[model samples]
Target: MTSFEFPGQYYELMRRDFRNLAAETDFLASLLPDGGRALDLGCGTGTNLRELGARGYCGVGVDQSASFVEYARRMGGEGVEYVHERVEDFESEDRFDLVYCLFMTLNYLPRAELRRVLRKMRGLLLPGGHVVLEFGHLLNFVESYQPYTVAHHRGDGVLVTRLARQSLNPRAANWRNEETLLVREADGRVSMYDNFFDQAVLTGPEVRELLADAGLHVSAEYGGFRKEQVPPHGRGPVVIVATAEGAGAL
Candidate 1:
């Protein structure tokens, strides 16, 4: 499986402190009634899982990184159950009211693997249930794809600067993202860490076809946070809300 085990707690620290995706969780909560069960695919740090639990939903989180899973379990307690396994290998007898594949996690899988995971997710959902997907779109690459990205985030008396360099492979529909992080402590101490990972790049038609082939269909497609309709060639992540097969016929 893909491993991000390098740099120890740096990756966990960088992500565990981030809570911006709480808005996505809020949006999802608005769609479900009480007693909802949620499965978070690629649920890094279990932030969304904790948020869903706080909102009165039963939550399960899965991530391929063992460190991430342990951190999630430590933070979420009994409210959220975190599994240290790939989404493709994770299974359960319980069906969910909502399934989440967010933050471009599906992009990490190759095309055929993406289809298989989607099919597995479909089987884990109840009738009328929905799966929410957010990932880079074709336009995202054309309009916003940058070879390099740098950012600094503030924390308790420490400043963390992240540098990302990416190389795209149009033929294989994939890309390699290399990340280096520099952590500057208040006491004049500094440490640098790095890691690299590959992601599958996909177009709208490709994603739509995969969903349909997996017995799922897109119900809503948004380009932004406020439910903006995805344009022909728009920027920002593509947020697609899909439903299990025969959901409307029920």
Candidate 2:
């Protein structure tokens, strides 16, 4: 399976999407403990880390992309540290009060890799720490659909845009697929990558089992961070908040 990395343009798009930024900030704020230390896993460009730091929390971000990490470090303040490393290989001498994996970043890994990463996340949390995870709902892709396309106008000419059809390996334990497309214009050309995570459909039960195996308990699962329960055949994303079973007492 191919790994997903947001291009610089996409990262900037996320930074400008006020609605999404507000929703995410609200969700993270709700999950934070008083003056807590927070970890942003797969933190692209460190946008969330900067927000957390602005809110007076000690925030650290980790990502495999060196350019992204450098950009994040330059953009984020001193309170927010950006680390260049894969989530599975990230090690810390101290535990955090909260760990977050957002934007379906976990879906990039296969089942075993995901499990191992989750174990690492568990190990990086303090006793009362919580993990807030978000991923796309797989049920949305049960049926095939035409690709969505968009084009932008350049000063001299029009940009060309196309989205190609993609499919998930239904038989695999980690059922997921990606849609890759080309973005071409007079200035430059680039590939845009978007992945559909059907892991919720193929591994929801297994995810719960694995969390339990890791000594974590599911506190809640929402259709989105807005706090709505996921419905049967829900086409929205899934946001999960989990914690160590007895961590609340710590």
RMSD of each: 2.7, 4.4
In candidate 1, clashing pairs total 0
User: Please, what's the RMSD in Å of model 1?
Assistant: 2.7
Q: List residue ranges in candidate 2 displaced over 4 A.
A: 1-7, 14-19, 143-164, 173-202, 247-250
State every prediction's TM-score relative to the real structure.
0.88, 0.78
Among residues 3 or more apart in sequence or in different chains, the pairs in candidate 1 whose N, CA or C atoms overlap within 3 Å are none
- Clashing residue pairs in candidate 2 are 138-198
Minimum summed lDDT over a 10-residue window in model 1 is located at: 1-10
For residues 36-152, could you state the per-residue lDDT of candidate 1 as single tens digits?
888999987777777778878888888887777877777764457988888878888988888988877888766668888889888888878888888876666667568999978
Q: Which model scores highest in TM-score? A: 1
The window of 10 residues in a row where model 2 has the poorest summed lDDT is: 153-162
Please, what is the whole-model Cα lDDT of each candidate in the order they appear?
0.77, 0.68
Per-residue C-alpha lDDT of model 2 across residues 1-250, encoded as one tens digit per residue: 4343544444454345323776788788877887888999988788887877888888889887776777787775747887888877888887998999987677655556777778888888987789887765456445433345343323233232424444445566344444443545455755555533334333466667777777788988888767777877766667878898775421
Poorly placed runs, candidate 1 (over 4 Å): 6-19, 186-188
